[model samples]
Target: MSIFKKVSESERNTKATIFVGNIDPKVNEIMLYELFIQFGKIKSLNLPKDRISKTHQGFGFIEFKTEADLKYVVQIMKGIRLYGKLLRVKQAENKSNDTKSVSNKPRTVDIGAKLFIKNLNPLIDEKYLEDTFSTFGEIISTSVDREANGESKGQGFVVFNDFTSSDNAIKNINGKILMNSKVVVTYAYKDDKQKTKHGDKVERLLATNAKKHKMLDSSTQPTKKQKR
Candidate 1:
C-alpha cells in the first residue's frame, strides 16, 4: 500500500513539458527521444515535419510524465550548450496563434499580412481559429500553443501576405468578437528587436547568439521590455 501511494504521487508530480530548441536539421524523432530520455520518462515527442517539404520544422516538443523531470530539464538545460548551439529549452509558450483553413464561406474583406493578432482564446481549438481567419484572406500561417493534453494556451499568430487585405480585415472585424474572445491587432516584428533595445554591446551578443539560435532569426524584434 505504501508503494502504491508513492507511485501515485510520483506520477502526478513527474509530468512536465519542454520546447526543445536549437535542433540540428539532421536530427530526427528517435534521436531526440533518446537524448531527452536521460531526463526521465518521455510522455511524447512532437516534431513537426513540413508536409509540403517533409523536412524538420527546426523545433520540437518533449513531454515528461512527471514535473520533476520537466522542471529539471527546463532549469538546468534552459541555456545549456547543445550541439555547439545554446538551446532555449523552457516551458512552452502558454499562448500561441493557431491556424484554421476555411475553403468555403467568404467574408466581406480579405485579410492580408498588414494586420497581426494576439491574445487568443485558450478553449478555442486551432482549427477553429484558422477557419475564422480564412474568411478574411489567404493565411500565411497560424501558430497555436499546446500542452500535454494538446489543448490551446490561448494565444497565437496570424499573418497575411498583403497589407490591403489586412486593412480590409480590420475594418470589417477588428472588434466584432469571435470565439467568445476579444482580439487585439497590431504589427508583429521579428525576434531581433530585443537585441536593439539594450545597446550595441547587447545587440552584438544577440547577433552572435542568432548564429547558434536556429529558433530565432537575425531580424526578430525583441520583447517590449527589451526595447531601446
Candidate 2:
C-alpha cells in the first residue's frame, strides 16, 4: 500500500513542515521522496528550481501529515551525510503569522543603531542570531537575508534600541565563530549621512588613542634639568 494513501485531507490541512538545506544538486524530488517515505507519510514536497538552469535549488521544504513524523525525520536526518554533504534540517518558519505580526507593529526607525553581520552559517536562523547578541542590549529587530525560496544568503542585520548596544555588539561579536562559521559585524549604514557619521566616530576614536599613546611616551622620557 502507498504511504500517502493513508493520509486524509484533514491531516494534510494541519501538516507540519520542515526545511532541508545544503541538498546535493544531483538529488531530485524522486530521490528525496524515496528516502523520506520510510519514516512517515508525506503530504507534500517542494523543491524550488532555478528559473534558467531548472536545477533544484540547494534547499527544499517537506510537509508531513503529522507533527510527530516531522519531528522524527528532523531528529534522524539532521547532519546526515548525503552525497558527501551534511544536511541542515529544521522546522520551517510560519511565514503567514510572521507577516501578520510584523504588519501590525508600529514602525520605529533609529539611526546608527543597526549592525550588519556576514558569513553566517546556514543553520543560524534569526532567533539564534538574536539570542547570541542579546547579551549586549535590548534588540529592536533581527533579520537574516534569504532568497525567494528561503535559502540563507549567509548575512543578517541586528537592530538595537540604541547606538551603544549596536557598537558593543560590533566590538564583541565581530570575528567570533558561531556554528563553525566566523562572522564579520559592522555598522549598517542606511544612507550617505550615516556613513559620514560613522567615519567621524572612527576618526574620533583613533585620535583619542593617539593622544593617550603620546602622553605615555612623554612620561617615560628622562628629565634634562640636571645640566642647568
Candidate 3:
C-alpha cells in the first residue's frame, strides 16, 4: 500500500478558506493549483471572475483539507511575490456580505465616476478593458470579477479620472458588443461617507487590539525577580 492515506472528497473541504488578493492578472488556475497543492490537498479553489466575460478578478479563495494546512500556507506565503505582485493571503471573510444575502446592498449607494459593467466576454482581460475603454477617455482602473476557479463572473468595474469621461463611456459603450457579447454599463454606486466611517472604525479597532496584544505579551514575559 502507498504511504499516504487516501482522503475522501468531502473530507478535503472541511477546513478554513484562504483569501488571496493582489493577484497578478497573468496568473491562471493551473499555476495557482500547482503552487498551492504543495502545501496540502485543496478541497476547492476559486478565483472570482466576471460573470459574463469570464475573466480573472485578481483575487481568489483556496479551501484546504485541514486548518493546519490552511494556516501553514498563510504563514509561509506572506510577502511572497509572484508574477511581479506581492500576494496578500488571509482568512476568507464570512458570507455575511454575500450579494445574495445583503438585502440593502451598500454598493448601490456609491457615487463616483466609476462604472459598473456586466455581461463581459470570458476572453477579455484587464488590459483589453483599458484599451477598449480608453478611446472615450483616460481610465483610472479596470477590473473583472472572477469566481474561485478563476473563471469569469461576467461583470466588472471601470473608473475614470473624471465624470465627463465616465459619462461618455456609458453613453458610447453601453449595450455595445464586446468580444461577441453585449455589455451593460452604468454608474457605479458608492457611499463614500459610510465607507470612510467604516475605514476609520476598522483602523481604530486594529490599533486598539494591537496595543492590547502588546501589553499582554509584555506582562507575560519572565522578569529578573522570577529568574532569580
Candidate 4:
C-alpha cells in the first residue's frame, strides 16, 4: 500500500520547502514521503522527471506546512544515507524575485572579463560575491572555492559579459575592505607563468601606491610655521 495514499488534501501547505539532492533514480515519491514524514507532516513532495524518459531528475523538493518542521528535517537529514548515497539537504533559496521574465538561455562569457579574487572572508559565499559585484555589470557566473565541509577557501572567480565591467570592478574593488578583510582582485590568467608574473607586478604596485599615499598625506599636513 502506498503511504501517500493516506495524505489528505487539507494537510497540504507548500510554504517552507527544502531541496534534496543525490536522489537515486529508482526512488519514488512514496518512498520519500514515508522517509521524511517520520520527522514532520509534509505538504508536498516533488521529484522532477524528464518528459521523455520520465526518470527522476536526481533531485527533489519537499514542502512542509510549518517552518519549524522544515528546519527540523534539514537538521536531521544533513548526513543521512539513503539508497547507498549520502543525501544533500539544504534550505531552498527563494526565487520569487528572480528575473524569470528574461530569456532562459545561458549568457555568454567574455574571456577578457573573467576575474580572480582572493583573501575573501570565510563567511562570503558565491551568492554574496555575486551580490557584491553585480552592480558593475551583468555577471555570467560566480564561484567560490569550498572545502568538503562547505567552508570557504578564501578565493573565487567572477565572470562578466564584457571587459569594461571587469575593468571597472578591478579599479573600484581591488584592495577594498570586504567583511573586515582586504581582498585582492586581478585579471584571471590561464598560464601559470603569466599569473605569477602579473601577480608579482600587482603586489609591487600596491606596495608602491601605499607608500605614495602615506607620503602624500604627510606632505599635506600643516607644519607649525604653515599653521602660524
Candidate 5:
C-alpha cells in the first residue's frame, strides 16, 4: 500500500472535535472554554482531573457544533504561545472507542471553513500566510506549523470566517508558487481520528508476518538423511 493515500472525495469534508494537548497544568476547562469560544459554538469541553489533587491532567478535549469551528481551533490554536509553552492540537478520538472496537470509517462530519496548505517554504510565517490568503476574504486566523525547536514544518493553515472565502482561496491560491515552491491547499481533515485503528492494523499485520516466518523456517529446515 502507498504510504500516502489520496483522500477520497468523501473525506474532504469533516470536524467536530479536537484533542488539546500540552496545555498548562493550571489551565481548567473554563479557561479552555473561554479561549476556544471565540472560534465558534461549542458542544462540550472536557478536562480530566486528578481525582485526589483536583488538578487538570494537562490535556483536554473540545467539541464544536460545526466542523468549521473545530477546524478553526485545530489550525489556528496549534503551537500558540500560551502560558510560556506551545499548545498541541489535533483531531480527537471517539469517546465510544473506550468501550468497543473502533471502526475503520469515521462518522459523517461537516466540512469546515479552513484550508490546509502544504509544501510551504520553511521560512514562511503566519503573517505571510495571512497576507497571501487575505486576498480572497477576511481571514479569521492563520498558523505556521513548526517543530519543537521552533523551526518551520513546511506547512500551515489559513482559517476564514466563512466557507466561501476559504473555497475561493483554495481555488485561486492552491498550487501557486510561494517562496519558490508550489503549495497544495485543501480542506482541513479536522474530524479524522483513526490513529488507534491504524495502529491496530499494523499490529495485526506484524503478527501475521511472524507466523508466516515461523512456518517458512520449519518448512525450509533440512531433514536428516534416513539410514538405507
Candidate 6:
C-alpha cells in the first residue's frame, strides 16, 4: 500500500540518468558538479553541449558509485533550487544494449590516428554514422551530438584502427556522398575529451525529464474535480 510500491526495484540501482533544462546558459557541468557531488561518490559527469555554440543548455547527467548514492541524490535534489531551475533527478537510461554493436564502443586496438567526418545528416545516429564510415576502415569509436532532444548536429567523430584505413576512408567517402548532397566526408581527428562529458549529459538530461512526466490511467480517468 505504499505510495511508491509501483516503482519496481531496479537491478542496477546505483547508476542514474538525469535531465536538465531551464538552465542558466552560462552554467556548465563543472559548476553542476560542484553542486551535485555533495550527495555521494561521483564516478562520471557529463554536460551535453549545444550543437551551435558548444555551450551547455543547463542540464547534464551524474553517476554515483552506488544505488544508495543515486537515491540520496534524488531525495536531495528534487525541488532544490540552483541555477534558478528546480533540479529533476532520476535513474539514467540503460543504453548498454544499444552499445552492443562493436563498431560503436572504443576500439582497444588503437588506430594511431583520428579522422574527422563531415557532411553527416542531422537525423543520423552514432551507429548508422559508424556503418557509413566502417566500409572505409576499422572504426575505433563514434559520436553524434544529442542536440534538440534527439537530433544529430550534422557532425561527428570516427577513429580508425590504423592510419592506412583512416586515409582510405577519407579518400573514398569524401566526394562520394557529395554526389547526392548527403554529406562530404573528410578525414579528421576523432572528437576526444569533448564527447565524454556531453554524451553523459545528454543521457542524464533525458532520463531526468522522463521521470517528471505526468501519466493518466484510462480506467481512472479524471473528472472535473480531479482536473482542478
Separately for all candidates shown, the number of backbone clashes (residues 3 or more apart, or on different chains) is: 34, 0, 34, 0, 0, 12
lDDT of 5 by residue, 3-105 (tens): 1222332332225767666455457666777888888877667665543335554456666778878777777875575453356677765544311211011
4 against 6, candidate with superior lDDT = 4
lDDT of 3 by residue, 173-222 (tens): 99999999999988654543433322133433543454366522232222
Which regions of candidate 2 deviate over 4 angstroms? 1-109, 191-228
Per-residue lDDT for 187-224 in model 6, tens only?
45224444232223343344334333422112112122
- Which candidate, 3 or 4, would have the higher lDDT against the true structure? 4
Candidate of highest TM-score:
4
Error of 5 at 66 (Å): 40
Alpha carbon deviation, residue 37, candidate 5 (Å): 23
List model 2 lDDT by residue over 104-169, tens digit each. Answer: 111222223567889999888766876898787655456676766566788877765445566678
TM-score for each prediction? Answer: 0.37, 0.40, 0.40, 0.43, 0.40, 0.38
Candidate 5: worst-modelled 10 consecutive residues by lDDT: 101-110
Tell me the whole-model lDDT of each prediction, alpha carbons only.
0.49, 0.61, 0.59, 0.61, 0.57, 0.48
Candidate 1 Cα outliers beyond 4 Å, as residue runs: 1-15, 95-228
lDDT of 4 by residue, 31-94 (tens): 8989998999776787655433356545666778789998899999975755444566777654
lDDT of 5 at 143: 66
lDDT of 6 at 42: 66
Model 1, 1-228: lDDT tens digits are 121121222333223766665454457787777778887887667665543335554466676778788888887675444333334476654313111112111110112143445556776643565567656655444445455555555555554434444445666666667767787765444344533222224434543454355433322222221100
Worst lDDT window (10 residues) for model 1?
Answer: 97-106
Q: What TM-score does prediction 2 earn?
A: 0.40
lDDT of 6: 0.48
